[model samples]
Structures are given as structure tokens and as C-alpha cells.
Target: MTRRLSLFGATGSVGQSTLDLVRRDREAWRVGVLTANCDVQELARLAIEFRPDVAVVADESCYGYLKAALAGQGIECAAGAAALVEAAERRADLVMAAIVGTAGLAPTMTALAAGHDVALANKEALVSAGELMTAAARASGATILPVDSEHNAIFQCLAGGRIDQVRRIILTASGGPFRTMSAADMAAVTPAQAVAHPNWSMGAKISVDSATMMNKGLELIEAHHLFPVGLDRIEILVHPQSVIHSLVEYIDCSTLAQLGSPDMRIPIASALAWPQRMATPCAPLDLAAISRLDFEAPDEERFPATALCRAAIAAGGARPAQLNAANEVAVAAFLAGRISFPAIVDTVRRVVDAAEPAAPSSLQDIFSVDTASRAAALRFVEQYEHA
Candidate 1:
């Protein structure tokens, strides 16, 4: 069965990994559309390699560059957010949503609105507009497959059990590179040190989120949305090895885990094949040679971001949207050396505090809150820049 596919954010880490897997079995999938943000050259190169029906670059300024790169090819080319959203409606059997931030929220929802199954890699889509996206999926009978490793693990573990039979879910974190670093040391850390993840190869922003343990917090929020579990029932453990993707404990006391090498392809393939398994290039986990696996409780004092995430979840409504929007702006500022390490969460905390989180009944509401949060976060960054 040749599955028609569309990929949004086709130049990021997850997007590149997906392309590696697609290249491995290119004959098994049809490339309907491929989209990227400002990476015109890579997008055009991918267009040449895969010959997708349409290729879109999210930055409107890069349109001519992408168009010229693919000038002679029969593949249609487009640019800007609307073009990217339009690509989501191109009649693909599976849509891979790998766009990184709140910018991805709408396109992922649009894919669902167009009745496409989404292998979702964008946590912001759920973190910012979870109810909206999940509701859109249900209304359109669209399946949302978790592409994040931890959520994918829980999905794998829950294969046979009913939602009611679930007792708890445990998500493992690498504890990141700074799991043991003192808060004082973290405050003085550089962007170079922050993105140096001990376990996973990720983009700069997510790596810093991991450094602060906010990635796990955001994932906790994402888990609440993805799984049929409450925040109290969802837990995080500092698993330094990152070999155990995640765990599910049944009401009967059976804890089932999905174990594999730390590789995004594993989950991407799982979501792509789903119900039926698919092989990935990740090395098989060697249990005996490694000898042991260890887990510890997450240190919330050292990582207040976890507690803030819980607060956002408790606050509900537009608070999570604010959490995500503010965090994105904060992370970008940190990456650009405009904000210090600890100041990242301080920025997010300030924005969430100012939020009057009302339940959003529409995407317009989410975007409105998102816009305000970003504006507030930028103000915080600007103050930090001068101070």
C-alpha cells in the first residue's frame, strides 16, 4: 500500500530523520507536499530528490529563492504561512507535523481539518491549542499519532488496554546535560553549554528546554493532552540513559515500557506504520552489556519549570497557550544570547503570571492569547537586554 504523505517543517531535525526513513522506503510512500521555514535551498533539494507535488517555504521572502531553485521542475512551489497551510490540504494519507513552535499550531490543525491523519511532532500544537486540535481531529475523524518518543512509548504500551484500565503513566527524561548542575552554575551557563544535550540530537531551542527541564514539563503538558490521563496521574523520572522511552502502569500493577536506543526515527516509524510495526535504523538496545538502568525523582527545586508547567495545567484555558508562546520567545532570546539561562523560565513565569487564562472556543482565541504572550515575553527580554 503506497501511502500518500505530506511533511511540514521538512528541514528540521525530526523532518530530516523522517526523510531518512522515507528514503529507505521511498517506494512505499508518495510525496504529496513538503514544507519548510526559510530553508529554501534544502526544501528545493528535497523537492528535486522526492518530487513532491507541491513544495512550500514558510518565509515569504524566500519564495523567489525556492522558486528559482525548482524553476525547471514540474513540482509546484509556494511560500508564506497560507501556502504552508494550503499544502496541508493536498490530500495526503499521512501528514507529518514537525514544525517547531506555535507557528505550527494552525497548520497541524488545518491538516486535521482536512481529514488527514497527523503524526504530530509539534508539542506546541497541543501545548498551545490541544483542545482545539483534538476537537478538530474528532470532528473530522482524523487520527493523531504521537511522534514524540515518550508519548509514542505510552501509546505503544497502551496498545491492548482500555483507557479505564490505566493506572499511571511515567515519562523518562535524560535529566538533560544540567540535571546535576547547581542553579547558580546554570544561571551562568552559555547557549553553547545548554544545547550540548547528553542524549539526543535536537535543535537548539529544544536542547535548551531540556537543559532547564522545561522540555519534560512541556512534555508533561503534552502527555496530559495526548494520553487519557490526568496531571496527577502523569509523572516524570530522571532517567539519564534515555533508553526507556516511557512507561505505562496498569490498574493490575503491570508496568509496560517501550525500550529502544535514543532515536527519533523509532517513534516516527512507529507513528507512520502504527497498529503494525516498522523497523528503524536505531541500534537494538543492548541490555546486558549496559548492565543497569537507573531512575530518580525529578528535582523540582532545581527545576521550577516543572512546577510552573503544573501551574499552567491547573490554571487551564489560555494559560498553557501563554506558557508555550512566552517560552518560545524566551528560548529564542536565550539562543541569541539576549537572555541568560535561568532568565528563560523567569520570562515564561512572568508571562504566565500576567495571563488571565480564559478558555478559548476557537483558534482565533488561541492566536490572540499567543500574540499577547509573545509581546509580553519580548518586553521581558528587552528589559533583560538593557539590565
Candidate 2:
């Protein structure tokens, strides 16, 4: 049986990887919708090849180009944020919510509300609106399959087990490229250096998040929502090898882990074939060739983003949303050369600290907090830029 599929952020790293897996087993999926944010040409190229029922670009201005490119291809093309949400509501057996940042929240929620199974790769959706997103899933009977490698690992580890039996969920980090760098040395790092992850290939924003260990922090918050494990029981370990994706410990003192090469497709494939297995072109993990694996505690002093995220989730309410918003702004600033690498977390810390705690009850409230946080983060970024 062929599963109908809708893929958001079709031009991104995760989207490309998902498409790669789909390409290998083309007969297993019927492409319905594919979306990207302003990459009209690439989106058109993918739409033409995959021949999705419709292609959407989030940026409204790019609609003309996208439409023209897809003209006579028998694939409909649309643009703007509304189209993204509309596409998510389309009939599909599975929705791959791969759009990065908070922009993905609405469409993801739309899919869940429509009772579609969502393969979630966008951490910001859960990080920013965990309660609401989960509530929507519960009300609509939609399943949110974790697509992030760590959460997916825990998902696999907990198979046939109850959450109550779980004692701890250990998420592994690659420690990025600056695991051993001193604070002083890190302060002088460039965006290019920060994005050069040691083990995984990713977009610039997330790559920088790994450099500051913020990605792990965001994952921590994401894990809390996904696994329902107490935030206190969730821990982070710096595993430089990137072989062990994550671990879950049982109350009976047994630990279960999912090990794979540092390939995004591994997790994407996991979600794409939930309760079943799929084959990928990735090389088999050779334990002998990569003989040793090492683990260490994360250093919060040098990379305080992880700790900040813990505090935000602990505080609950608007803090995690604020933290995610500020971090997104700060990351954009760093990438644009508007602030120093160290200032990225510093700006996030300041903005999150200064934000007023409030429980966002609706998507509107979350966006309000996100908007306010971004403004505050930009102000802090400017202060750092001049200093």
C-alpha cells in the first residue's frame, strides 16, 4: 500500500534527506504536497521530479517564479504562509513537518488538528508550544512521531514499554566542533567555524546551535514534551562519537539505546517507517573500525545555553517560547555578522531573563511572546554589536 505524503521545508537538509529515502523506495509513497521558504527554483525542481499534487513557497513574493517554473508540469503551485498551512490540511497519510523555527508551528498544528500523523523534525514546534501541540494531538487522535535523532532513539528504546517504567532518558550530543575550546577561544569564533559541525551535516542555524550546545538544550525541552519523562530525569551526555543516538534507562536498572551513524536519514527513515523498518543507502555502523566511544558531562560554564533551556522549561509558561524566539534571533544575528559568537547565547540569556513569564493559552499568545522576544533579542544583539 502506498502512503500519501506531504513534506514541508522541502529544500532543507532534513527535507532533502527524507526525499532521498523516498527516492530509493519510490513506490512506497504517493507525494501530495511539498513546500519551501523562498527557494522557488529548488522547490520547483523537486515538485517536477516528485510530481506532488501541489507545491508551496512560504514567501508570497516568490509565487510568480514558482508558478512559472511549475507551469505545464501538471502540478499546482502556491505561495505565502497561508498556503503552507493549507497544504498541511490536505489529505495525506503522513505529514513531514520539517520546517525549521517557529514558522513551522502553525502548519504542524494544522496537520495534527486534521488528525494526520506528523513526522516532526521541527523542534521549535514542541519547544515553543508543547502543551498546546500535544493537546491538539490528543483531541484529534493524531500521532506525533519523533523525527529528531535523540527523541527518535528514545522512541525506539521505549518500544513495548510504558513511560512509567522509564527511569531516565539520556540524550547524546556530538559536542559539536568546539567541545574542547575555552571560553576565550570560543568568543573569537566565526560563524563559518561555528557551523562546521564535527559529525553531522545541518543548516547554519542548527549547526551554530550545536556549537553553543543550544541544540541539546532545545532538545532537552523537546524531550520533556515528547517522552513525558520528568525534566529532572532527562540528562545530556557529551558523546563525541555520535554513534549512540540516545539512551533510555528502565526502573529495573536496564539501559536501552539506539545506535546509528550520524545520518539524518536514519531518524527520518525511522519516522517514515514507524512500527516498521526501512532500508537506506547509509553505510552500516562498523564498531571495529570506530573502536572507541567516549562520554562526558556537558560544561554549562562555557556553553550555558543548555542550562538556560533547563531553567526555561522549569519556569514553564512563556519562558521556553521566549528562549526559542530569542535564540533564533540571536542566531540570525550571529550568522549575519551583527553579533559575536559568544554573544549569541549571551543575547538569548539576557532576553529570556528579561521576559515576563506568562502562560500562552493560544497560538496567538505564543506568537505574541515570540514577537516580543525577537524584538528584545535584537536590541540585545545591537548592544553587543556596538560593544
Candidate 3:
């Protein structure tokens, strides 16, 4: 029987990669639902291509355009967050939680609560509500699969091994666009320059996160939640090649690594077929052609995003949500030319440092921290703009 799937963020990089794989096996897969935030054209195109039972656009303003685009196509049309949540609980065997930021939390949790297996590509969802998410997964008996390359690698390596026998998991970083830039040079980098990742093509926000190593920091927090391990057990290594995705060190002093070309499809396909490997569209790694491998420690002094991420994870509760919100606001300001590129980390640090950690007892608690954090970040931007 073909497994039914619901894809959220159906227009983003991860969503597109997932659709590519699903389209290849249309005979063995059924596209139950597809959703996009505001990309009416793309959503309409996907609706035609996948022929899902329902198509949802999160932005209410784009509903008419999307609805008209799918007129007479016999597919159900819905709008806004309610539509997304409704899609989350529909007849989907698997849910791809690929929406970019913290905004993905609600619908993702909705899917988990409804007992659908989740292929999670959005690290912010896990970062923001790891405890709540995992608890819901446990209560509902739903599986939470990791779609990030680093976490996916660790998940693959941990197969058939006892968790207690694991020593450490080392997550590899591309060192992003600023690996070699001096601190003075980094301070003047424009948004375009920062998003220009040398090794991989990704969305702009994620690209900027990579440049500042905040992506790695968020992954660090994600690792803490995904694996039953302490923060000290997770190490970040700068591998400019992007060949070795991640490594798992065993208690017996052996290290196992997952290597591949810089392609998101490899990890996405792996998550889609857990306990069974499938053909990935990603190019095979050529060890003979690539003769060298390099590694370095992330500089906490220059790229303070790493330190800020660590502090947020250590603080726990709503701190991670606050960190994510502050970073998002700060990055947006930087991208809009309202702040220097380097000030992204500074703004996040100041906001998180000034904010008090709150115990998030419910989803509202998480949103409360998120709102206050954004406010703090905006206030920081205003002060900096006037300074």
C-alpha cells in the first residue's frame, strides 16, 4: 500500500527536495496534503503536480490567488493557521515538518498529538519546544525522525547500538562563508555576502545562520534533545569540505562517520526510509578525487553566536525559544540593512542575556517567551539605530 504523506512548507528548499523524492516514487507514495506560507504560485504548481487531497496557504491574503489557481481542480482549499493545523491532523501517515522557523511548532505538535510519524527538518521546532514535543510523542506513541544531515548521520550511526555505549557525537560544520575572514572583515559583510555559502545552496535565513555558526549552535541544542546525551558530549568541528556530515564516537574508542556530498536529499531520503537505505539523488562522495580533509575549532570570540547558543541550551525551558526569536529578529534587521552583520549575534546575546528564563508549562508559555524575546530584540535594534 502507498503511504500517505502531508508536506508543510512545500515551497522551501527542504520541502522541494522532499517533493523531488516523492515524485520519483509516485506509484508507492500518496500526497495527502501540501501547504505553503505565502507562495501562491508555487503552491498552485505543487497542487497540480502532486494532486494532493488538500492544499493550504498559511497567509490568508494569498487564499484567493491559490484558490483561483486550483479552481475546478477538485482539490480542497484552506487558508491560515487553522488550515495548517487541520492538515496536520488529516489522513497523513507521515508529516514533513519543514517550515523554516519557530512558526512550525504548532502544526508540528498537532501532527505529533495526532500520532503521525514526523520527518522533522525544522530544527527550530525541536529547539523551541523539545520537551513538550518529545513528551507529546511519547504519550501518543508517534515517531520523531531527524531530517537534519548532522542529526540524521548520528541517527544512522546509532542503529543497533545501546545508548549507554555511546561516547560522543561530533557534528561537522562547513564553517560557512566567513571561516577565513578576520573579525574586522566579518563586521562589514553584507547580507548577500553572508548568505553566499561556498559549499551548499540553501535558503537565505539558514545561509546567514551558517555564516555565523548559529546553525551549528541550534543543532547543538537539537542534539541535546534528540539524543539522551549531555552538552559536553556534543562537539562541533569545522570541515570546510562538507563531506563528513557527522561522527559518532563509541565508548570503545572507535569513531564512525557519515560522509556525503553537500546535498540535503541524502538526509531527507534517509529519514524517509529509516532502517532501510534507499537510492538518494545526491551525488556520491568521491574519496579518491578529494585528497584532503580539514578540521578546526570554532572561534567563540569572533563568532559569538556559538557561545550565545550554548548559553541558551544550558539555560533550558523558554531560553532556546527566546534565543531563536531574538536571532530571527536580529537577522531580519541585519538583512534589511538596519544593523551590521556582526551585530546579529550581539543583538541576540544582549536580548537573551537580559531576558529571564520562564518555565514553559504550555504552548502559550512558549509563545509568551517568543513574543517577549522579539520585543527585546527589536528594542535593541532601535537603540542601536539611534546610537
Clash totals in order: 0, 0, 0
Model 1: CA > 4 A from native: none
* lDDT of candidate 3 over 302-373, digit per residue (tens): 778877878888888899999999988988898899999888898998988796866899988998898999
lDDT of 2: 0.93
User: Which pairs, if any, clash in model 1?
Assistant: none
> Residue 94 deviation, candidate 1, in Å?
0.3
lDDT scores for all predictions?
0.91, 0.93, 0.90
Best by the lDDT measure: 2
**TM-score for all models, in order of appearance:** 0.99, 0.99, 0.98
Lowest summed lDDT over 10 consecutive residues: which window, candidate 3? 273-282
Q: After superposition, how far is residue 283 of candidate 3 from its true place, in Å?
A: 1.1
CA lDDT of 259 in candidate 2? 97
275 Cα displacement, candidate 1 (Å): 1.8
Candidate 1 to native Cα RMSD, angstroms = 0.9
Stretches of candidate 2 above 4 Å error? none
Better of 2 and 3 by lDDT: 2
lDDT of 1 by residue, 178-283 (tens): 9899988888999999999998999887899999888998998999988857889998889999999999998999899999889899999999998787778879
Q: lDDT: which is higher, 1 or 3?
A: 1
